[model samples]
Target: MVKQEKVKVKPLPATIIPPTSWVKYFKEWHGLKFPVITCRPLGRLGNLMGEYATMYSLKRHYNVSVVMNSEFKSRIKHIFLNTSLPDIPASAGPFQLQDWTPVQNIGSLYNYAPIELAAAGLLGPKKFIMKEYAFEMQMFHQFREELKKEFTFAPNYTNKVNEFLSNIMKNRSSQLPDPVFVGFHIRRTDYKKFVKNKFGGHLPGTSYFTRALTHYRTKYPDAAVFVVASDDLQYARAELQQYQDVYFSQGFSAGQDMALLSSCNHSIITLGSFGFWTAYLAGGEVVYADVTTKHDYRFSRKSFEKFGLDYFIPLSVD
Candidate 1:
C-alpha cells in the first residue's frame, strides 16, 4: 500500500475588523449590564447637595434612584422640582441582587482600582448603594451644567423669589444707582459648636463680616446691598447693624433662604457645604469665606479645588 503524503494547512491572515460603535462599546464596557445606584441621603438642605450631586455624577454611568422619604421630598421639592431623577419609595426593600455593592464614601467610588475594574467590565456589581454623604465636590463638578438643568426651582418658587428680589431692589433709594445684591450666609447655632470643636479659634469673628462688607463697599463704591441669612438671626442683626443697607432674612424657611441666597450677585459664605453650594449655584462674581477654619475628613482643600472655589477671597478672623 502506498502512504498518502501528509497535507499541511496554513492559517488565514488576521482580519482587521473596525472598532465597535460607542453605544455598543459602552454597553459591553459595563459587562453587558447597566448599573443602578440607590441612595438614601440624610442631612439638612446643604448636606443634601452632596447626595444629589453624587447621584448626578453617577448618572453618567448608571441609572440613579433616590430613596427620598416624605420629609426629604417636602424639604427639597420646591427648590429642586425638576430633579429629573427617578424616585423609589422610601419603604422599598434592599436591592436583592447578588452583585450589589455598597460604596460608603466618595473616595471608594472614585478610587483608581474600582474605576479601572469598572472600565474593564470586571467589577462584579450591577447595583450600588450609596449610604454616606459623598461631599467631595469633585463628584459632580464635571456635570455642573447638567446639574443646573436638573435642579431648577419650580416656577412658582422662582416667580415668588423674583418678586421678593424685585421688592428688595425697589425698597432701595431711587437716587442711588441699582445696588449689587450680596448674599451673606452665617451658619451659626450648631455650626458655632462645630467650629469650636473642629477649628479652635478659627471661627469667623464679627471682624470677618465687617472686613468683607468694607471690601465690597470699596469695590462697588456707589451701592451694595447685603442680604443676611443666618440660623442665629439676632447674631447677624447685632453684628451687622453698624453697616448700612444690610437686610436680615429672618422669617424665611431654609429652602426660601437658599433660593434668596442663590439670587444674589455675590456672596459671603461660612464653613459648611450649605454655604459652599449657595455660592456655587448663584454663580456670583465674588465669594468670600474664612478658609482658615480646618475641615474635617469628609471635606478638604481638594474639595474646594474640585469646584474651582479656591479663588474665594479668604477672610481673616484676626
Candidate 2:
C-alpha cells in the first residue's frame, strides 16, 4: 500500500495582545486560520524583535502556532521590569502542529496588502515588493520612501489614530497659527536593556524641546498645543512645565505609543524607536537633539531629512 500524504490545514497568524497592524495580513490571507496563538503583553522591544516578530514571521510564512503558557505570563508580569533580555528564552523551534485544537471558520474581512507590508518589514530593500505583489503592493515603494522620511515611522499607524488627531483638532479652536505645529518626545526608557536589544540603543538627551516650544510661543503667538509623549511620565512632566500649553498623554503599554503618537499633527523625537515611531506616525516636520559622539544618542538630521522632516529649532541641554 502507498503511504498517505498529510492533510495541510491552513493555520492562522497568531493574535498579539495589544494587537498591531501585523494582524492586517492575517485577515487578508484568507486561507490561513484565524489567530492560532495569543501573545498578550508583547510590550517590550525584546519581545517585539525576538519572540513577537519571530513568531509572527513563522506564522505568516510557515503556519506555526505558539502558545506561551498562562503560568508563564503570570510569573513574568511580576518580574518584567527587572528582567533582562537573556532572561527570556527563545521558544522551541518549529512549533508542534498537534497542539492546535480545531475550530470552525469565520467570515473574511476586506484584504489590503499595502497595509500588511508596513508591519511585515516588507518595505525594506531585502524584503517583499509591491511590483511583484501588485494589488497588495500598491504604495509599497512610494510608502517605503515616505517611511524613510521623518514622519514615516511605519506609515500604517495613522490609519486608525483619529482619536488623538480629533483631540488636537478640537483643541485648535482659536485662530490658527502661522507655521503648523510641533511635537515633543522625551524618551526616558532608551537605555534599559529591553530597548537596546532591538533598536541598537538609546540616544542622549539635548534640551532642544524646551527651546523650540519657547521660540514657537514667541514667534507664533497663536501656535496650538505642543503634544508631548514620554516613556517616563514623571520625568517629562517636570521638564515640560515651562511650556504652559503643552499636553501630555498618559503612558501606554510599550508598542502602543506609536498608535497614539501617529494621531498628532507634528512631533519632536528623541533618539529611540519609540520616538521614531511617533514621528513616523505624525508624518510632519520634526526637531531632533544634536547628538554628540560621546553621548551616542542616534537622531540625525540626515535620517529625518530624507523624508522631508527637519528640525525647526535646536534645543540646549544647559
> Which candidate ranks first by lDDT, i.e. highest?
1
Lowest-sum lDDT 10-residue window in model 1: 13-22
Per-residue lDDT tens digits of candidate 2, residues 1-318?
A: 111222333322232222333333344212323333323333444222223223234334434333343432453433223221121123433323344332211232113233243334333212121111111111221333333331222333443345565666676655675335556777775455534654444454434555556555665576656777777878788877666577777555443455566555666766655565556546665555544332222244333333233322234333
Q: Which stretches of model 2 miss by more than 4 angstroms?
A: 1-142, 145-161, 164-181, 190-206, 218-220, 295-298, 301-318
**Per-model CA lDDT versus the true structure:** 0.60, 0.43
Per-residue CA lDDT of model 1 for 1-318, tens digit only, reads: 111222233322111121231111233212223344545557888888777776665555433233333444566776787776655433444334343465564354323223223322244434555555555455466676787776677776677678877887888778898888888888788876876676553447676777878777877875888888887888888898776688877446777777788778888876677777777777755445534544343332334543455445555545
TM-scores, in order shown?
Answer: 0.75, 0.45
Model 1 stretches with alpha carbons more than 4 Å out: 1-34, 61-75, 89-101, 106-123, 198-201, 293-302
Q: Candidate 1 clashing pairs? A: none
Q: Please give the clash total of every predicted structure, in order.
A: 0, 10
Question: What are the RMSD figures for all models against the true structure?
Answer: 16.1, 17.2
Judge candidate 1 against the unseen true structure and give its global Cα lDDT, from 0 to 1: 0.60
